[model samples]
Target: MTHRIQLAGHRWVRLVTRLAVVLLLATGGLVTNLASTAQPAYAHAYLVETSPVDGEVLASPPPAVRLRFNEAVSFNERSIQLLDTNAEKLAIGTPGHVDGKANTAQVSLPTDLTEGTYVLAWRVTSADSHVVSGALTFSIGHPSATAAPVEQDAHRAVVVVDAVGRALAFLGMALALGGALFVAVLWPAGRSDRRGRRIVWSGFVVLAAGTVVVLLVQGPYAAGTSLAGVFDPDLLGAALSTRLGHALLTRLVIVLALGVAFGLAVRHGSPPATTGTATTATAGAAGAARRIVLPAVATVGAVALPLTWTLTDHAQTGVQTWLAVPATSLHLLAMALWLGGLITLAACVLVPAGRRETSRAITLEPALPRFSGLAQVCFAVIAATGVYLSWRQVGTWAALGATDFGRLLLGKLAVVLAVVGLAAGARRFVRRRGREPLGVDAAPAAAVRRLRRSVVGEILLGVAVVSITAVLVNTAPARTSYAPPVHTTVPVPAAAAESAAGLQDASIEVNIEPARSGSNVADIYLTGPDGSLVAVPEVSGQLESPDRDVPALPVTVTAAEPGHYVANSMSIPFPGEWVLRLDIRVSDFDETPVRVRFTAR
Candidate 1:
């Protein structure tokens, strides 16, 4: 009889596992299709180059300061400032995008300028709506006697508070959602259990507290001000004016509604009741009213809560956002169900937290099998959504080892795998105990104790996963990890263009790749007076430094296309200002020569 029962159980488990696999595959295919139809977008932008390069010394004040980024940027005019060594702000025009260039910002400066070191601090909003800021120093005439560093203490405090607030909010939501799902769907007895009610209430409190802290910190964070500036009305106004701020405000409102709905759903025998129930002692009409009103309100609040997280985080800005947003929401909901349910199971059923003066009316046997099935379903959804999100966020295998975000994701995956393994072990104990008699015995007691220990271990691993996720959201996506340093562009004067030769009235443009000492490629562009490309029969160049008396290095130029010439190999032995002279022969009869000066260091 025992052998037959074991075989039957094994067959049932096989069927359920197969069904989970099928469901995951179907869902994954649908998400992929949705992503293919969504709009194209990028992640974060990186600053690639800047005008008046950092640590540069200029003889005259530049008319305008410029910044060049790898991805297109939207300037934040209020965050741009030029401060002197004494920390005094200088007069400057409003920053604007350069004509025909979305990736560059230019701001004009006052004509009259004194000699001293100055810091140019700027902040801009990226294409994805994330804020980025940086500072660089340039000396006017000569280095200053005393230069104050850029302010940073305010920024550091904001980062700390934001991180803490985000973590707390996520944890609280998971506990609340998971605990409520467990009580409503699996353990109806939990509706009246004090311990279960407390678990759900705690989640509500933590989430509410976290929301307030985040809202308070947003003001100072955006203004880059000190902690005391959190109350500044202008700073608060800046924070509330953005799309992210609107999402946060909506979250607070959702929390209030959730509290009311949850209170009705959980507090039994009250005029309102959760778990779709009413007080037995109450009159029939009141009981019927309680049954209809409370569950509907609770259901709406539960579904709307996770949507707030989806709108504010990486999902809103990531690639294929149409698919990403829903995938992330489902992932969060599944995680809450799995992790939160495990906690409920351990506390209320498996271990029975309170004193067991006598066996309670509720038994663990009925709840265990139902929880097992629910957990399997939740894990399936999590696994499927996790795979989709990983592909969306970290596109390449190289990024898995190279970027901080990728590494954190890898760590989270490992912990979850361990948790799954422990869960499988507990499931085996359940099956083994099932084959034996139903009453309590030495063997049955041992199995139940071992299963509880495994469940506890899974809960600990779940906490680690949540903590890593909080940090990962703040990190930049790996796609924009590498960027080349900024280089100077020198447009040689047309007066020096050897006129009367075939190359008459032609202009020359030489761009040095990386513009640094060592092997580099020099791309020479030739244009006519009409701004059209001028084809040349022959072109050659040489790199030399008059100050250092460096030996002239010959650079051979090959025609890539009409008016485009490239030198495959141009070697620079040392750092210094190097002059590149391009000799162009438009025809056999005319030879045109032009020269431009640029720094290599």
Candidate 2:
């Protein structure tokens, strides 16, 4: 009877050991899946090239300004605009129309215009619905303008790519840590029970694989090159030379070292021989503690790796950066733990039993409670961190609808809510009572099946979240394009008076000469009652014809020598009849509003 009892005890130990190994392998597979799926390929829109090249000096203004993008763009309100040096509004003839079925927009410019320097301002809505806008200044002649070029840095891209890679790394760490914890807490004491050792080995292999991928891919990615360029020594050297690169390299070394230490522990610290009750308990505790240490170290390293990247890459100061880093870190870790745990539970606890056709032999009886606890923690972390991250990225409540980033975030949140509902269902099932063959009440087999299905649902939703996140990081911030308005002023001259048959002051001869090409200049030469030229001090006007309510044209008048005042660089808003109300300040005469109609071309 004593020998039979000992043999049954050994069998039970062996069974639990196998279960643990399978769980670890499953979780490792989850980490691998995340590593493969969560790559940063779908983020922001890229500008391929531009016509009348950015910052190129043109002798004459181009008929239209064209911008080509890698993806389709949205033509919404305030999508594109053109402004001249004097802050006078230049007409953007029409909305952006598709160029020959390609993703490009051509905005037409006015034909007749005196130009010194003009700024082409554009706002393009990326295919992902993120709006990106910038200004480029080009001179007509040798004139100088004080506008600077917009700078584009690879910092955001690096952060996004590194985040995805570190997410995978964290997944591996969680699997290894959780597996180690399980092994320590429930160590089987039998020579045949080699499951704990197998799990530890599998975890190490996953960690090593994830580390290699990150180390290899990060170099080329940092250099803004494709995967094929990863092996280039120059690219690798540049990446390693930077602060971000060096930190990532250090993380890789630490992870590899941890893997090595885990392997050593597994080899030299096998469970002690289980001779009797006291020996079995002592052996189990020792084996469990040994298994636990390696994963704990791995978890610490994984958490630190992402934290380092976040600190070095995110430039926001004070509480903003602090809040963003921790929230993002927790968000990443929770995703890994939940996804990795699901995989472990499925592969180790479910697949083997199903394969062996002994569905009842390795029942969900012992595994459900542990999984439920893990799921609860995962949900809490995902929710809390997700809320914090959304708050940081979307500053205003209206931004949720105003910007593309906020919209995608909303979609991700909805999916997460659904996942939470599914988890709730699983929790309910585990708590319910059911009959057992041994006369002990336990969770029904059907409940376990439902729990598995819920986990799968959670995994699918998690994938959607990753995809959304991948695209969100590429978009520009919501508040970048809305800059304050600029305002300026200019002067207009009167038309030269013509000699009539009886009245000499009836006719005025106005010579409209552009001081510079692409600028609005109207010169008016007026003959006074005494046959002397008079200077018009101020001129107020409106473009009256096809379009009304044109911008206020600023006019400035200068005396060419003495009597003749030359109006130079007077801005005209559009092509129409412009009524000039000139306040003629001649000697001691009353300020007169002289209305004159002139057509602008």
Number of the top TM-score candidate? 1
Q: Mark the regions of model 1 whose C-alpha exceeds 4 Å error after superposition.
A: 1-41, 48-78, 85-108, 115-117, 124-131, 136-155, 270-300, 352-362, 434-443, 482-601
Per residue, candidate 2 scores C-alpha lDDT tens digits across 322-383 of 46666776776677566655555555555435564453356564555566677788788888
Cα deviation of 243 in candidate 1 (Å)?
1.9
lDDT value, residue 194 of candidate 1? 82
lDDT for position 354 in model 2: 52
- Per-residue lDDT value at 230 in model 1: 75
Evaluated at residue 280, the lDDT of candidate 2 is 69
Q: How many residue pairs collide in each prediction? A: 1, 29
Q: Which ten residues in a row have the lowest lDDT in candidate 1?
A: 272-281
